[model samples]
Target: MDQYKLFLQRMGLIGTSTFLVTITGIMLLPILTQNLSIQDYGVWTQFQITITIIPAIAILGLPYTMVRFLSASKSRTEIQEAFYSILFTVIFASIMGAVALYILVVPISHVLFNGNVGVGLILPLTVIMSALQLVFVDYFRASNQMTKYAVFTTLQAYMVVIFALLLVLMGRGVVGAVTGILITQTLISLIMFTFVLKQIGFKIPRFHNLRQYLTFGLPTIPSNASFWVLDASDRYIIGIVLGITSVSYYSAGYTISSLLTILTSPIYTVLLPILSQFYAERKIRETRFLLNYAIKLYLIVAVPAVIGLSILARPLLYILSTPTLANQGYLITPILATGGLFFGLYCIITQIIVMERKTKITGNIWAISAILNIILDVTFGYFLGIIGIAIITLLLYLTAFLITVYYSLNYIRCDFYVKFAKKTIYAAFFMALSLILLNPYGPVNIVLSGLFSFALYIFVLWLLKGIKTDEIKFFTGMIKESLVNVYCALRGL
Candidate 1:
């Protein structure tokens, strides 16, 4: 169908961006790891984790409203109105957040940082830029401008990498690193963000649609707050309890491992607006199909990816990280990958929940999940060093997937847990079995072991007939279409 083609096109664009980002990361990280000191890098990472705390306040749940509201708008005029309202909201919040940061800089600085007050000045700018960027991003996504959205995200990433490298080589140190992020975001907001926003038609925020936006947004503030709380509380608490060095190790480990999330995150970004619209139109079959298919694709890729990362974590740490990070990275990689898989599943399920306007339900799930994260992260961080913390975070995410699936099953089909296990488990098991058979002894052997494992996994999938009958049909159809298209190109069809 045309729709399926469109989805593939969107997926390709987004996938390209993801790949570019991964490559950029592969290039940028070694330089950063080699250049920066562990404590300074840790402090730098604290800044990174700390910023997630702001959107909870500054965007103030506007993202959730923007996705749901702007996606459902039918008329161009109505969508325009929503964009203006959101723009005004972004600007207003930016100013307020900046001012609040100015006010709270001293007291909270002492409390959180124990007198290292410079992070205070950095907070306001980062929060403002983040606020503007979130609104800009959400607006574009809600408008279904996938190609431009994809380009913007890609360029923004490249810009960050370039700037960070420039800053570091200039000897600006940690401040330079943070400056790179601030500069990239601000430039995007000024250049691409505001312009494309105007193309969709700009107006000042008006009273008419304003109430609906706020009505939709306000209740979820605490729910979103819970996410911020859960994310930052661990870092902040660790910084406080385990010392800044602990924060640094944890931060570095998390930063390196979180590239997996960054790569996969955009797929969810592409799916949400489209999914919301499908749900709004009551296209139940298509919606259910995507939901199931996404889950299947995630399991297929994520399982092997997780195992492979766990297998490679020790060497990956040695190659890509500093002494502090290398030590922590080996332990963190698998745990983070496992958690990342769960989070990916949660995103698909949560999109279903969001589409159904069951945000309150989703919120409660996040809240309980956040609490679990806190208890486990704190307990683990305290008793077992950071590995314990890592495991706890992974467990919480898996738990959330379970909770979300339990709640959102009515909105989807193809019991994914069943489909996933039957399709992939035996295949994956055979892959692991291949590693035992080969019995490679060194890093080259280990690398070969992973390669053989993947080959066996694919082979078993072929043998079991579990690659989804639809996938074969789709591939064959694609080949046929390609030949026809080539003929048409020759004949000017």
Candidate 2:
């Protein structure tokens, strides 16, 4: 029971922080679209995709090892050694990555932007800052410092919004936006590094079990890179095949679809450390229960959310971006939203692999999926335009989830509640029906209709007894606890 309460508290903090990030991202869509031309936005989108993959490659997969190893450590000295080892390793890699970025800037720019190499000058700095930021943020998460993690993440999001918007408004275009990211990450990285140093102190990393860390973390580079291929390669394909303007349209729809992750991501953040701890302690029953509950909770929210996004994709695109984006890219949301749902499920299921120390299996799974995703994305894009690439994403995740689930079951058993899922599906169908009957126009109507649809879904679920009383009590407790925490913080202020 205490464990459950702690989980909820952690969830509330991380969830609130993730929610803030989603809001900032949503806000940035219109600001960026209005400020930069579609072509420029496409270039920015391409740059964003590069950053996602490059830093993962640069870090040599050590951050994930932090989550695995650091979470399991007992002694403060052991924790410090593991933390600083990963930190020093990532720092070295960041310097190497910056140098590589500088050396390859012209070629990369030519490939991604058709020889528009002006952004190359700052790409190295962005890459370095991003790599360090990734390590710092992951360290906090591994240490179970949820409040510090939330504060740093939320600060970075707000800073990016404020600075990026100002730069764009001042006519810096894509360069301004990239600069905003660079500056914000640099500042936040310094702050987080200081915090981590204070916590871990300035001892040599001792290089204890360094080979174990490498053996565990190294294989994940391909896995992470492949997952990136699954997630972001489509934009590159779109940019290459259809041109930058289409990339912007596709990116707008992709961003809207990513809203689904806001629901799952925070839970994912909390789940990793908890699962790691539970597994390490041989608490198999507890681990199984948490896994089942997470799956159910994700479906209960994700099913309706996916349906609703599909229903309101166009209106959302229109309100959040230009009419051009709405008209050209609205269809991309339903596909990607559904894909996002599968991806979230995969995250939950794949924890079995992580818990079992079958990290290499993860690498193999994503490597296979990545190859298939690239093949499908490229072939589909050639034949079917932007929608083809979008469909590829959904298909890729569905495939990955099935494969991961099949392999994961070998390590640990997880339940899937068919009757409960059927109930959720029925309720979601009715929610979609309600929204269709209303067929809301404009942002205000759409927002209201969504709320009505959600309330109706819950009411239907209650009527069907799909939602248990204990679950209600759990959520109520979470709300009450969060409120008390907020009040105390205000009093402190």
Candidate 3:
């Protein structure tokens, strides 16, 4: 129980951070969509997708490797060597990636950036800084420094949003937004590097563990690339097939749907390091327990979120973006929300494969799924437009979830709490029905209806006994303890 509480506390910290970031995104979405032209927004979206993919490829999954190996290390010397070795390797690879991006800037600008040479030129530097930022941030995760991790994560989001909004408001447009990102990345990287250096001290690594780290981390590159394909390739396909304007519509919908990730992201962040520690100690039962409960907790939030977001998609999008975007992109939300739910589940379950160090299997699964996703994206995107892309994405996520479940079970069994899931769905159905009857139109009504609907859902779930007393007590206790900690910190200051 104590261990579970500790896990929840850490998760809550990161979860709070993620929630703030999500709110920042929600606030920024309107500002960007309203301020920028649809075509320019599409360019911005393309730039984001490109940066995400490049860093995922360039960092070589070494950050995660650090989490896996360093979670259990107590030796300061050993930690120093592994950290420096991985950091240096990632830096070298990222620079090489930046050079490659610079060399290929012209064609990439044409294909993705809509021939914006300035954004293309800025891309290489952004990729390098972004890659370094990733490594530095994961250093905290590797060391179980959730407070620092959460603070930096939230800080970076706000910084980027503020900088970009200021630049865009000054009539700098998509290029300004891209430049804002580069500036924020560079500053955050420097800050994080300084803090981490102070904590771990500096060491010149012998690269003794470099081979082992690569052996573990390299296979995950395919998985990471495949994931980017599943998640972001649709933008490219839509941009190519329909037009950059259409990409804006698709991306707007995708952004609204990705709210589900706010629930899953913290779980992934907190789960990995702790799970690594448990697996290293051969605590299989604890590992299974944690995984099972994590999925259940995620579903508790996510199941209703999917339904609520789908039901409120139009109003939410209308409030956040233009009416035209709301109308064209609203349908994409339900499909993507459902798909995101499945993908979130896959992320939690696939930890078992990671624990077993069978990263090759994970890579194989995503590699196959990515190929299928692209083929479907081209066919369906051309014929059925963005809706078809959404449907295929849902199918791919579901397939991945099913396949991962199969492979994951071979190593450790986890209960998915089918009855609890049914209750959640039942509660969500009623919430959706209420939302439909109310028919929220504007931002204020939408906010009210959303709050009322969520409260009602909780009430209904409680009546159905889906939420047990002990579970409620546990979370409330954790919250109270967190409040006390905050109060003490403030008092100290």
The digit string of per-residue lDDT tens for model 3 on 268-386 reads 88998999988999998899899998999998889889998899988888889998998998989999999999989988998899888899888888788878888999999899999
User: Which residues of candidate 3, in runs, are more than 4 Å off?
Assistant: 477-493
Model 1: per-residue lDDT, tens digit, 360-473? 786676667667777777677888777777777777777777887888877665457676566687787777666656655445777778887887787678778777567756
Top candidate on lDDT is 3
Candidate 2 segments whose C-alpha is farther than 4 A from its true place? 483-493
| Candidate ranking (TM-score, best to worst) | 3, 2, 1
After superposing candidate 1 on the true structure, give the runs of residues whose Cα lies further than 4 Å from its correct spot: 22-26, 107-116, 219-232, 410-414, 417-419, 430-453, 468-493
lDDT of 2 by residue, 386-492 (tens): 88988888987888889888999997889877898899989999999999999998879999999999989988987889897787787777767765664454354
For each candidate, the alpha-carbon lDDT, in order, equals 0.69, 0.84, 0.88
Checking candidate 2 for backbone clashes, the offending pairs are none
When 1 and 2 are scored with TM-score, the better candidate is: 2
Q: Against the true structure, what is each candidate's TM-score?
A: 0.87, 0.96, 0.97
Candidate 2 local accuracy as lDDT? 0.84
